[model samples]
Target: MFTRLGVGVFIWVAASAAVADPVLQQPIDCTLGETCEIQQFMDHDPEQGEQDFACGAASYDGHKGTDFRINVPDMDKGVAVLAAADGVVAGLRDAMTDRRVVLAEDQTAVAGKECGNGVVLRHGDGWETQYCHMKLGSLVVTKGQKVTAGQKLGEVGLSGKTQFPHLHLSVRKDGVPVDPFAPDRDGQTCAYDAQHTLWAKAFAKGFIYQPGKVIDIGLADRGPDLADVVDGRWSDFVADPNAPLVVYGLAVNGLAGDQMQLVLTGPDGEVVNVTQDRLGKRQAQWFAFAGKRPPQGGWTAGDYDLTVRVLRDGKLLHERKSQVQLTR
Candidate 1:
């Protein structure tokens, strides 16, 4: 069962924690769900309780790295995968082509080639990082080449043994796989061990460990996809007065019994529609939208605001807002 709450005032609370690690910088230009997000984290506790570098179940059994992901459509458009730290290129692979395999079962050709197009870097001391699932033919560095932090290495892609587009970053110490979240280089961290996390304190703190997240938002004549979001497909809207006024959005990490609410407001401050419904069983990712054909004679001109919210057990979980303008 789901309940719809009236449009209330927006409030935000800030929680800050100091970072403990200062060696590595974020290797990508996008933030969580902005241009990219940590799709998966290394699985430290694989036998029973699965935990990510953040000590969350965002990861599954035996996952060996952190997956920084952009939507498939965005990967096709091109998003750079940068070096997280200064290091010398140790190894690389670029033979695999970049193509969406829609399903994990269909990735046999690149089976053992899990890291389809990848690069391994050797930093000072015993630290080594491997960047995986890069776009074919997009490699910008060569073996043995020294690179600085933030240097572009390649683009994220859906090559190898992945069903989506992402860069799998694997960190190792003395050739042993290590969870970056574990400063002690042991294994994994449970939720209660947040203080021992090794992530750049600032970058780690900003990421919300919630189960549901609103990834992208847009206004389109039709439903938009990951590719559409990357291309700025719905950035502009013309008031056809006779056409459909649609606002679409994408979400991930959804669970059963979740509720969604979408509120659309017109330029004249009139409420267009408020779509609310309960979601089905568990879904790793979901796309939800709301729209309707314009009223007779045409539509109103001016600014429009779209607000989306996800709720569980009557508690607000996630909220996103996007503004679009209607023209004459």
Candidate 2:
């Protein structure tokens, strides 16, 4: 989940503290993709908590929506994003950034970087889906409108803070982020080839790992626990009036698949297991990565780097590397 899982409960309570709204029902079609497990799928990596992947596309930061990369011919062709179910679109933040980083808003700053265009949709149980950094004018849905699953919501493009055209989708519960990698982060390790070893299969599962959680890293402690803090920055999660914005200003490609195997490594090569969580959203499918809860000692201080790769036919299409710091 976004922020930290330990604090998610509190944050959820706080998000609902001021506003009182009903949780949207399952608005999307749950039977769109294979729901099979495919790890190292960059496009549709999600957290299912060991359950079959709800969909292929994966969201790294529990941004809250299920995504599929459209890993077919023409990675471009302006990918078409669809609605997961029927629900009213909410959180419309329409503004252009001032600074010029990439295609992102000229004014916004992300971890010292800039961002692009994005959107957000609210659902039940604090669940919300977001799509980010799309083409300038490709959205098909309008504000305050209701949509059904697989509904053409918009076309993917390289708009806000994007190097290439992609969609950054996420899901949030009660305004709290849920791990797209279901089950646990270190549950499965993706293998490049049946012959190539080194716990590679986890990558194919496309599940969310727990180590990615902000809480597991002990971000709140004022103590010198985590070390080698690199690539650290924070941003506010606001619903874009123009489009759905992924947290930290990211882009989406498409959904990964049904189920995914996850494999992760922490500081000093310590292994972490995780899974993906797929659940229907008020508008679309949302995913998160789950894994064995961090140790009770509150984790250990260390420098960690995670290399996540998504592949097909033993070919690496997409991959992500995350830096982490923790100390207890």
Candidate 3:
């Protein structure tokens, strides 16, 4: 159901008659913090500066869309990108090869293929949305077709002007790009209005922006797949007493001068491994791990603990704990 309202040349579909807001669903099929991460948001700043939906520095310069990213190792595993609302396919591009392009080294080759594989959707009331960076051959919908909210559009990919695997979603109203988080990126009104928001009331809660967050953490026998680190294979799972053990975590929204500490404790209350350091510059995401071989007589058959801490200026910012079991 959609309610139409017109204001000059611009218009929007109200999620409900009583609300008068154009509600949108999450444009992906995976759970946040489980299979994906909100890498970057639309630049709330109008002059190509930096700001996010929450008025934070999570976005980069001139970033015009919301970036939902997946781990690089999982890019080939086929994660589906979905439509945010019911709409007709405006157009699409899919012939580009699904390959990584390092922008700093070769900018010329990626001139016309900045968006790589993309699908454009035209909703009622002059609203439009574009999903970019799809896998080369994974586009499932064609031009002029109708798609319901949550319908699969394509798989996320590393194609185009991207250093990571992600889906870049651009939202527009009457041809002008609008920030979905709020009406104006600048000024005194930080409150969200229904007329200015394009997300479902329920979906809006999932987007509470955090400047620094530990997305995932776990223990592993080997290192870890760059894509799928917490494979659920080590959590409470039995491990060989003598096998080398590793504790790792992935973080997002890191700033310059942030410090990180990782510690792994054995069954006998002994510190097996530790890592401490300060990060440099701004970063969208970072990963770290610590590991060591078992003692000469092998680890005791008991529970082990791993803890991760992220701090800035001596203040605790984030902390996460993971565990594993060992057997003789």
Candidate 4:
């Protein structure tokens, strides 16, 4: 199984000889907070709790890698995974099929191959980097071949024990996992220490710590299915003037007590507005929608606007606005 290091103290005692740190570039070819986002980070907690470098619950217990995630639709189009630094290919695996693990049988099938279709690169000075969950048959570099930083390695995939499509980048020194965000800090402390990050200057300057944000929003002719939304089926949806109008929003990392609201406005005036009850507990991913059937004489043509907002403690956390055109 592709298990990670268990919770324990991480003290960086000085070595007799100093090792050069491996400076890293962005591993995925996508804009952060737009086409892709950081789904998770390496856990920094020393005990049984979970804490990301930003002191947020954006990570799970024992997570040893940073996850760069693109939505399913983007995955279908293919997103390239780049080498974080120049190194020799240490090893690779590319025979696994691309599929999500949703059943017990599926989990059993990927027991020892949890990091399906991955590559390991060995940098000098005991530094190494591993890229996991790449698409099968998409690898461009061969084992033992030298690769340059930012070289295209493969496309992201939904293989292994993943529930979503993402590229997991794990950094290591002397076979021990390291958090690129705060590599020198003690495991018990969690905070954004930009000066200690391994990310290249450009990427580090633009990085932002997002605890929760909306991923998708759209207007549909009828209530849209969650699967359809996730698959980008509603990306190009057009509504008929006489059909019902539904506005839906998808968000990630929603905390307990957060409130989601949806407002729809037609050319004529306000059509529907709703504020859902506070969430009972933390949600990794959640969706909220509001809509209404056409009026007595059918809806007015032109443009309809939908606004979605996430609120916590009566303050706005995130907001998205979308518009759809209705034709006769």
| lDDT digits (tens) for residues 1-328 of candidate 4 | 2223122334232222134888899999999878888878887776786777778887777788899888888888889999999999888888789998889999998887788888888989988999988888888888889999999999999877787889999888887778888776654555575666888888887887777777778888777888788778888887877888889988877889988888999899998889899989988788988899888889998888888888888798888787887878
Scored by lDDT, model 1 comes in at 0.68
Candidate 2, residue 158: lDDT: 45
How do all models score by TM-score? 0.80, 0.36, 0.81, 0.89
Misplaced by over 4 Å in model 3 are: 1-21, 103-106, 184-186, 189-196, 220-240, 270-275
**lDDT by residue for model 3 (1-328), tens:** 1111111132222122224334679887777766787878766565656767666677887776788887655677789999998899988887767666655654455566577788888887757888888998999998889999999999998667776778988777666666676644454554545545667877676555556777667777777765555333344445678777777777777888887677778768855556557787877778787777787998888778878877778787888777776668
Let me know the TM-score candidate 2 reaches against the reference structure.
0.36
Better of 2 and 3 by lDDT: 3
**True-vs-predicted CA distance for residue 262, candidate 2, Å:** 26
Clashes found in each candidate (C-alpha, N, C closer than 3 A):
4, 163, 0, 0
The total of clashing pairs for model 3 equals: 0
Best-to-worst ranking by lDDT: 4, 3, 1, 2
Give lDDT: candidate 3, residue 160: 71
How many pairs in model 1 have backbone atoms within 3 A of each other, for residues 3 or more apart or on separate chains, i.e. clashes? 4
For residue 39, model 1's alpha carbon misses the true position, in angstroms, by: 2.8
lDDT of 1 by residue, 87-204 (tens): 9988888778876666656666666676778888888666778888888899899888999988999888877777678888876655556666554533333453434444555766
**Of the candidates numbered 1 and 3, which has the greater lDDT value?**
3
By summed lDDT, which 10 consecutive residues of candidate 3 come out lowest?
Answer: 1-10
Instruction: Please identify which of the two predictions, 3 or 4, would achieve the higher TM-score against the true structure.
Output: 4
lDDT by residue for model 2 over 221-311, one digit each (tens)?
1212112121122211122222211111111222333222234455535444443332122112222232333444443456544443333
User: Candidate 1 — which residues are off by over 4 angstroms?
Assistant: 1-22, 53-55, 72-77, 103-105, 182-196, 205-208, 223-239, 268-277
